[model samples]
Target: MDTRNITYFMAVFDHLHFTKAAEHLGISQPTLSQQIRLLEAELGMPLFDRIGKKVVATEAGSLLYQYGMKMLQAERDAKSAMKELLSEKRGTVRLAVLPSDLDFQLVPLFVEFKTHYPEINLKAFSTIFVREEVLSHKVDLGIGLRGPADKRLVQVPLGSEPYELFVHSDSELAKKSEVTLEELTQHALVMYPKGYLGRDLVDDVCKKHGFELDTVMEVGSASSLLQLVEAGIGATIQPRGLLKQHSTWPNIVSIPISGPAPIRHLELTYYANRFVSKAHKQLSEWLIDFFKARTS
Candidate 1:
């Protein structure tokens, strides 16, 4: 009848030993036995059979076990739903972000967010397609250089960061602290695939500059592209924030670009009209402020 009684019964059923069940439940053996007896009395049936020191489930107990699991699961779900309704006290927040954002941007924001809401569990990952992850419901939130996501998703524009080129110090392009898109494009380009929001901007910039890109490699992540550039393989473009952070890379030269001055609008997006808990709102606002403060 009582949820606690069901839980105790399940524990006893699992162990099939009174002492072990009592130990597992952190209740005294006599107390556990008395509770089980009371539960059996309430149900009007014997729940267990004692043969020597071991206890085995009777027909009634086996049937209760079947229903008890569902009862516990339902109870747990109810509590979670209630918490989400009340305070958004606890739940997992699956998040997708770009690798460059992880170290400098999202990670710090997450640190502050957790400080405020320690009960919120987080799973943050970096991938090329954060928008798709959010749209498919694989992640509750996504952070990236925002572009056109599915109309079904909601976007919260955080801020914008200018894109720049990362070239090896010895490269001819590195001679200039600032270069035009046409100048940067002269070398082999190591960049994310065209599907990526940042890469799409790069493609547009290249087209506007009147040149088809000499994309030598279409890597999935900014880190890999940066590595290729760092190895003196070619020049790659990335956000200025990432370029500044890795500016100390021995042979890396991060040069600002000027033309249309392409800027990436970073956004936090989630499914539109989904039941966003208060915790989610609070965390999202915290992130908005965090990026705003950093980028400002």
Candidate 2:
């Protein structure tokens, strides 16, 4: 079937009204009606049911609508990707990331990437569920904690960032150069909401060490968690890089996790067989060296 027919069907499905769909498509109502009739005749079945003035999809129409959406999206994406290839100079890479890693991981890496490919547009969204966006193919790449189930995504473990306990300088724990999970659990815990990698790591450590964390409060972002810890609300454990910018906060202390330090492996994930533009490949290579330099 022609893509224009698919586009017309999608336009109708979206608006569910003949006149509105035609208006959106910049075509006259009768032309849109004729196209729909032709599509139905081609399929040998009526696609929509006219109930008074309202339009509703028939059984075949619903199925066609589903496939039509996918086809049109794929077409648009293919055109966009091809345009980027033809240009050979610039393109956009959509990226989704967890909020906690925004400043330390994403922002710096984006800046470094833009320095080389200044024309490459990076569209980034900071949220907890970047994986979903990647899964839906809405974003070209993702940076976040790995999920439980394996799929088609290719994940490259960049490096694991260790977690550190934060305490106010005047607090007794601040006197120590390093603090263990056991020691940290002795105080009230300020933490992230459940399902966060850092919070889960802290919980796992506390469980293994035969103690339950005294979680006094939970916040959404790492920055806010650090702010709460600095205010002496309670101590919290977070990735080491989170401490970099907040290093100068007065009365703030970062104590390394003792024993087997729980580390969250940062990964660069993308579709296994999906197209990787020149800019994307360069950014990926840069990340490899970037993390290596930091770890080294």
Candidate 3:
């Protein structure tokens, strides 16, 4: 089977829509269809079945997809290995990080990595769906909250930190070193929407304690949430590490939550079996050490 055709097939399989897959591949829809047809003819079996507006993969297509990913990964590994034979320091490492304080907090570390390996290209971005990006092979590494068990992934626990109350320095709650969950509910709060990872962590803890938070506003951006708190709108609960980054902002205060505080556990995850290039391996090791130093 042609590797190029296998690549096209996988794209179609992923989207289950010819037009969308074509768009993603930067090819015209007709061209994409022709490629699929050629691939099917070579295989001597139908790869996809069209049912009305939907496209579904056949058993043959499903089986091919499994091997197709491995084939693509092998091609990548070969290219990386050949490149390193010429210059050991050259390659790209795409990384996705949590779309919260953790994203911005890691900038210094990223910069340090770049300084050490100037030839390697580093592309980093923030997203709430870090695991999804890594799992889909869109990113080589992910730093985010713990995810559901997946044998295809290898997760290295970074560390866990407790959620603390962030309030304007002028607020009475800021005068205390810590506050109980019950006392915290007495105050108005600004929080992320229900489905957000950080919000869910807080919500789960509150549910276990038999009372809900008195949330006055729901904001999605972590920086916006802190801005609202600084404006004295309402308090927000976030990991203490987040507050540490904003320590220079005199108006905001971080108060620990007393008794069974909600904790956010983070991990660095990647494909368990995917090839690890030298640049990728170096950055991963650096990050592991960086987090270790921070938590220690």
Candidate 4:
């Protein structure tokens, strides 16, 4: 079986349209159709059912699609392993992290990592969809909240941190050592927009408590949200580590959330079967140790 034909078949299966799949594959529709027919003939069975304008994968095609993904991933891993044999220190480690952590926490660690392993190219970016990015193979590793069970991913526990109320020193709420979820709703708050993982986690806790946070502002940027709290515009709820790492902003004080605090359990996730180059392994170990030190 030709991997090229399997690739074409997967494209068509994903799109469910011959022309669209062909366009995505950068091939002519007729050429893609012919390739599919060849693949079907080789398998001795029809791979797809074309009814009117619809295209649906047959049972055999569906089973093959699952294995096809693994086969392609294996091919990629083989190529990567061969390339790494030349030099273990010279490679790229792509990472995706939460926006809040990226903005306020990880810069120093990243700088330290780069200083030691300057030869290893590090491509790290902030995103809300950390799990999705890792699963799609867009990044070699991801740092985010704990994700649901998936056999393809191996999630190493990073650490758990509680979300605390942040406010300027002059704010009345800052005088209190702690605040309950109900009391938190009474005060004006600034938070991440809906659909963000952080915001969704906080919102879920609020819903369980039978009240919603009265957010006066919804800022997508973590820095901006902290800025608002620093300026006394509105208080915000975030991981305690955010303010702890950045002591430059002395005015912002973090107050613990009493009565079922919203805790964010973080993990370092990567594909279970993906090749782990030396550079990748080093970075992963460093990240795990970094979090452990912080929590300790």
lDDT of 4 by residue, 143-217 (tens): 988878889899998888888899999999989989987897678899999998889889999899788888999
Global lDDT of each candidate: 0.78, 0.78, 0.86, 0.87
> Against the hidden reference, what TM-scores do the models get?
0.60, 0.72, 0.89, 0.86
Candidate 2 residue lDDT tens string, 49-147 = 999999998999999986785676577567768978678557788877777777445566788788877878888877667777776576887877756
* lDDT of prediction 3: 0.86
What's model 1's lDDT at 237? 84
**Sequence-dependent TM-score of model 4:** 0.86
Candidate 2 weakest lDDT stretch, 10 residues: 287-296
Model 3 regions lying over 4 Å from their true place: 147-151
Best by lDDT: 4
Best by TM-score: 3
Residue runs of model 4 more than 4 Å from their true location after superposition: 51-54, 112-121, 125-138, 147-152
- How many clashing pairs per prediction, in order? 0, 1, 0, 0
C-alpha RMSD of each candidate structure in angstroms: 11.2, 4.8, 2.3, 2.7
lDDT of 2: 0.78
Across 1-296, the per-residue lDDT of candidate 3 in tens digits comes to 76899899999999999999999999999999999999999889999999998999999999999889778877877787888899988888899887774546777777888898899989997788999888877788998888788999999988877888999999999889899878876898999998888888988988998998878999877888888998899999988878665455689988988897888878899999877887888889988776655554
lDDT of 2 at 257: 77
